[model samples]
Target chain A: MTTTTKNNEPIITVRGLRNTFGEQVIHENLDLDVRRGEILGVVGGSGTGKSVLMRSIIGLQTPDDGEIEVLGESMIGRSEDEAKNIRRRWGILFQNGALFSTLTVAENVEVPIREYFPYIRPPVIDEIASYKIAMSGLPANAGPKYPSELSGGMRKRAGLARALALDPELLFLDEPTAGLDPIGAAAFDELIASLQKRLDLTVFLITHDLDTLITICDRVAVLADRKVIAVDTIPNLLALDHPWIQEYFNGPRGRTAALSHKEGAAA
Target chain B: MAANGAGKARSSGVLPTEFISRTTSRDMADVNGTSDDHQGESVYRVAGALTITRAATTQREIDALPDPLTIDLSEIDRMDTVGAWLVYRAVRDRGAKVVGASRDEVSLLHQVSEFDVPARVRPEESSSFTRVLTELGEWVADAGSTLLGLLGFFGATLIGFANLIRRPKRFRVNAVVQRFDVVGVRALGIIGLMSFLIGIVIAQQGSVQLEQFGAEVYTINLIGRITVRELGTLMTAIMVAGRSGSAFAAQLGTMKITEEIDAMRTIGVSPIEALVIPRMIAAVIMMPLLAFWAMLMALLGGGIFVWLSLEIPPLTYVQRLQEVTPITDLWIGLIKAPVFGFIIALAGCFQGMLVQGNSEEVGLRTTTAVVQSIFLVIVLDAVFAVFFSSIGWR
Candidate 1:
């Protein structure tokens, strides 16, 4: 929780990362840094390797060539035991929630806690899961429901609860608000912001939602031309001359998002 | 309270030493120093950070203390939500009063307490005997419904065929041809090998049994009659059930899951006509041909086995096979082949169309398709046997 001491250090640093599938190169010489305790929103066109970059950093996909350092530890070529120790420090929420279909929500939340901290008793684990479920804005009864029984929005919240189970210092969320209605998306944005502040989590969020980027992200990283074109605040990014960036943040949806955010702040 | 005491007793005895050391060394908390104040109430002072890592040990320590306790959190430097939850549970369940919690800790404790409603972890289960009876009842109902559903599917397939006859241009010739390749052409190698081996076995075993009667030459009659009348179509049906039947279920099941079938429906395309009819046509036409091929291969195999082992000439073996095997046997086998194909395709498509919800259903329906079709084929084979014998075809 020593946020001040680590405030300037980058929690994730990628250098000269290159990824290719057959002949299609998704990323090449891509470099980016995620600072500590910041919600870094990564935006890119489809097929520009936004997910690929996230996958590479999370060790799900091996890069053809690059250096990835997370939490000051080199992430490449690490043994399974070494990788597991680092993996326990972060949690990821995939786009589709990816909740285990068989287990109930409470049991899903307990999976990581039981795996890592087996000494914690079941009742305590249950209590922790309940609170996490509530904190993610789900009703108490959602803890008993299976993933298939829950709607898409509730499933995402359950996924969020499970991701927060370990009280992870870092979180990776892929399209957390992709399919939600506007109000739900806004509420989700606020929830993530509050959780980030309360838990001192450094968030690596991959999203296409302009509202989320405008409302919560401390800085935005733009992916284009097979690499990150720019990483800056929304206002700073708006000042850039890149056509894709200009069109993206000043598009009709983007303007509406910015206007609503301003109105929200004023109100 | 009694349960808490027992839990503490068991946990404390079996608690790993490393866990205790890890918790205490980093976020060390002293649970001692119970004092009696002027009000005559016991005070439990918890020191250092209380987090999830130390949750088990902390809960145990709190459970062991006497009732009407005052929890002192003034000395704690840091606390997370898990820590707050533990403190909240202790206060709520044991009626402990907080002495000096920070404003943030109090808010966190309140937040955690607001969500503390009883939620069931798993569904309630009845007694084992009742559960078994209930499962048996459900299975019977399911089987009954499945049989009706299969009949409905067969009716729909027949209607689709009638429509195709009315509008011959609408018939999916390409799809049926593709299915022909998959269900028939690709199956020749395995079916040929299996029938050949079975033919050799029958010839070898028949010769041994007939040797005692000094009628070893009658092995040709056994091989020809059995292969042509029973094993040829029967084995082909079982193999096709395992191969093409399972594939039809899986393909259609996946299509249903992904909403491809629904997409076709919205586009005014009947999935029964587009997907099921082609497969049915291919299976029906290919089955008889494949069965005839299997019979020929078996006879050739038997001919080879007799020539090698019994020193019977190939021409003599062929002549014996023709004389001993009646045309009626081949007729029965061919007539049964299409019927078996129809049942296999119907079961496959029926199970597939029934699939809904998850990808797991595809696997389950595929297995059902194979088992149900094979079972029905055997049952029908028996019925066919009885009918043919009553007609004196035996």
Candidate 2:
């Protein structure tokens, strides 16, 4: 079915996805696709279910009804082993960097590697984990520190390293820049952009950070009114007359991001 | 031309499109059957995706070709990391032959193959004896700190009590009453039902055993003595440890995590007085009352069981219960209640206050609180039993 798209295949494809909590409809007939080797940004107002949408795709939150496919495998009703296999292929960095409090940063990075690649020697796993930690932009000495000891930004990096433990093809980030300062957030955005290119990762980035969208995202999907209203490049999105999109993109913050992006491109 | 096609991407490496063009959609050489791209001798034309998602099919297509076959990179469309890896694997298998990839493809393929697995170095394993010694040392340190924490909390509560005595306006009466209503009043149904069933089991079991010695009437003595002296307060304490003890840990631990306790301290409000002192006072006041209620429920259950099964009348059961159980037994049991309550409350508050960070800490500490409280309760009961036995209470 996807062969008709000509060149690139979607790493993730969701068609008519619906999710609700009791009478609260979070998403309805929502559709999205994360193409391979593309950083796709998901943006929405609060309570529009950006996290809920990510959670659904990752199998953390089950949708009420929908079709979700990842790498040609249906994710909606997949068995545990199948789901586990899919999970092994992709990694999710939660909003708060939910690293296990008991483990050091290095050990946290080794969790998925240990789970999926049990035959790999612990020493090799340790080496790979450290490499991944370094790759995620943390210093070599940061690996021994506990999550609680690290700053908010450092914890997010540790979580990214842990997510990249298996060298996943796809990366899901939930508000990666939510808690960081502007410079830190921009650095994070650059780190993600570099990592995506180096690893050929298909990134599903859920963020409220306009700078992240302008800097890294190849395409941005706007979620509104319980479904995806528009999916296009930031430039194309800016031209839309949708009230929410207009306010969100033409707001002071959005204007600053656009100006900075133009200056960055020129520089 | 190659640089122009690579677009504004900062990385000079072959973008996924390093292998772009020449597939024409009709011939998916990489995914299915090999297409004839007779660029040169021994050329195996590849097309379509060669990424990780389709690595299996793509690898199979590459493998089916004759050895020493060259992969025509120009015939391929998209080549990602895994796709590059599979191509590299083919190249490694073929043992280096003539190659012709676009500049982008060559660079990407080169970078992809650079991901090499390094040698492993095992972590050092400590000797079992040394590990055990270290563990023992840590345990002792932990015990000391825990004891100190409990004592410190106790002293803080006492000082708060003194302050409250001096100026009653500092008291959070509403909070104290709320804690009392939740901890004391809410737990009644479960405590009552459990005691009644325990009473029935004791009475029935005692009657059977005593009947063997032609002393069936001694069921009264067994029920009265055991319920008043041991089971009443002991069971109530254990139940509260599970119920209210864990609650206190969770509540206070959550407060600590959310910085509410820190906020209180910042505002010159003592957490001990506002949180711990109220719970302690409530427990101290309620434990004796709850134990007395549990004792009555147990006696009622015992009376009903004996009357129904052993043909003992209710009036006779009551009179016999009074004769066997002295008022001193009641006092001994009631006296232990407050002490047990204080210990349970202290255990919960200690663990709760110990919470350093995270929601998981709250949960872990809550479990620890319940376990420590119940173990302490049983230990206290045993200590009291020994003291009463030494004084010839029985």
Candidate 3:
């Protein structure tokens, strides 16, 4: 496959986005753009609406007020059919491996494929599903295993495979490496980086792993004080003079992650 | 945990479609698209993108041919794994050969062709008589095992009680009281209302049947005998099975799935003692109280009907109830309440502990808990009926 970078345009653009639950305002006057071929990592402290932002973008949650544009089209005021068509172009992997528990890993991947292309033959669907499964770094035998039979890491990969079933141009991943061991987490990060390059995919990743952000994020967005206070490269983000940013980057975990990245670069 | 940084990205977004089309296409004009060999073997042609979007086109071209056929990918523009699979599926079991495939296409076909284990074959339908007989045998086996499981659960509960007797300080009084409130106190209104309406309907129907024989006053005897001897305990058990028993199963099943029970074991706490005992004790304590209240409501309801319809005075109705129905009926009904409570609790706990895997199993076991408990309740009540009759309690 020919791989050419298409990086100028934004696939997702959000502006003046406000969400409120009674008197609590999660976001206000927030503006952000997710460009076409980048892995954009969104990080925030707990209760800062990182997931809410992702939810708002994917149309799972409606903002009280906002102008959301996806794929150069305004999404805020679209009809249901219009919204669904836009949503069909993208795939989302929810936190906690939101797989159908009753279905096997292969069947879970086939759900979206079947939904999108009902007339596709079952054997062809299985082939596509198996390919996606292999692409996600899962073992060949994982296809027939049920979600409950899988470990946490395997479930995450299965979820990723399902998300890729539609050959989506854009992918949204929520906390892809939260509960994994250090080695598993690193392997996951590499898998993501490899896939991002191979597919030339635009990835919206929500994560809390410092190493993940440092190693793979093309650009990082920091949510603070009810909105994104900074968006930049790893070095620029580290140099910022914000208190939470300072504590977060200069923190023990961040220092180690930075050291490890530097050593790897030198090696 | 995102990396926050300054603005410019070297690149972000998808690769252009041009990159995919940039791959060199090998044009071998010597090979023709379709050929039917002399051995009755057919060959089809495949072309176009083999990706998800273009897979259907390639599928249609190959799937229309007969089995034991070959496909020529010589004229194919592109083929991905999805496309490769479509071709493979058509030629899987047949005496078919693939000719003129590209190196990439050939590898992809090989990669997806091998199944470590093929998809489990679909179950075939059996003959009707054999199917019925098999189902009958399975049900009998299920019933046998379920009975044994129930008896084991009862013994385990009794052992837990014996341990409690040795260590009274370990009892969870708060848990027992909480369950009593949920299963007993909360159930009063419904149980009372149901038994009262039952009493009223029975009296009304009995009045109609006995009025022709000039025995309208006998409705008092009918209401007292049935309600005290059967309906009061039976209704209480049925309601408890639906509400408290099902709740017990769901609660334990959730704990089992979440590994809370496992946690308890690792920490040296028995799930039987911590979870099952309190519910069992609450059920035992509450069932009789609820059944007694139900019996009293039924008497009051029958009294209402007798006083209103037959113009029977309250004092006369009371005298008739006292004389016609012996104290033995109330005793028999009360004897059943605690037993039914024990059975319901055991059924719930048994099914709950049997839970494995996921939330679906939790729900399935919960339904089975209620059905099994209610069925056991009915069967035991029947046994009681037979026993009491043989002993001439009436």
For candidate 1, the per-residue lDDT at B147 reads: 80
Model 1: residues with Cα > 4 Å off, grouped in runs: A3-6, B1-35, B38-49, B68-78, B97-100, B204-216
In candidate 2, position B325 carries an lDDT of: 98
User: lDDT by residue for model 3 over B171-258, one digit each (tens)?
Assistant: 9999899999998999999999998998899999999999999999889999999999999999999999999999999999999999
Error of 2 at A42 (Å): 1.3
Superposed Cα deviation of residue B273, candidate 1 (Å): 1.2
Worst 10 residues of 3 chain B by lDDT: B1-10
The Cα local distance difference test for each model comes to 0.86, 0.80, 0.82
Candidate 3 clash total? 12
Report the C-alpha lDDT of model 2 over A1-267, residue by residue, as the tens digit: 122232468878999999999999889899988777789999999999999999888888889899998878988777898788888878889999999888888889888867765655454456666666766778777777878889999999999988877667789999999989999999999999987766667899999999999999999999999999999998899899999999999999999989998998999
Model 1 Cα lDDT, one tens digit per residue, B266-336:
99999999999999999999999999989988888888999999999998998888898899999999999
Off by over 4 Å in 3: A1-4, A74-79, B1-54, B62-149, B211-214, B306-315
Q: Which ranges of candidate 2 are over 4 A from the true structure?
A: A1-10, A81-85, A101-107, A114-124, A142-149, B1-125, B386-394
Give, for candidate 2 chain B, the lowest lDDT window spanning 10 residues.
B1-10
Sort by DockQ, top down from the best: 1, 3, 2
Clash pairs (backbone) in predicted model 2: none
What tens digits encode model 1's per-residue C-alpha lDDT throughout A1-267? Answer: 244233569999999999999999999999999998899999999989899899999999999999999988999999999998888878899998899988999899989999988988888888888888888999888888889798889999999999988878789999999999998999999999988866668899999999999999999999999999999999999999999998998999899999998998999
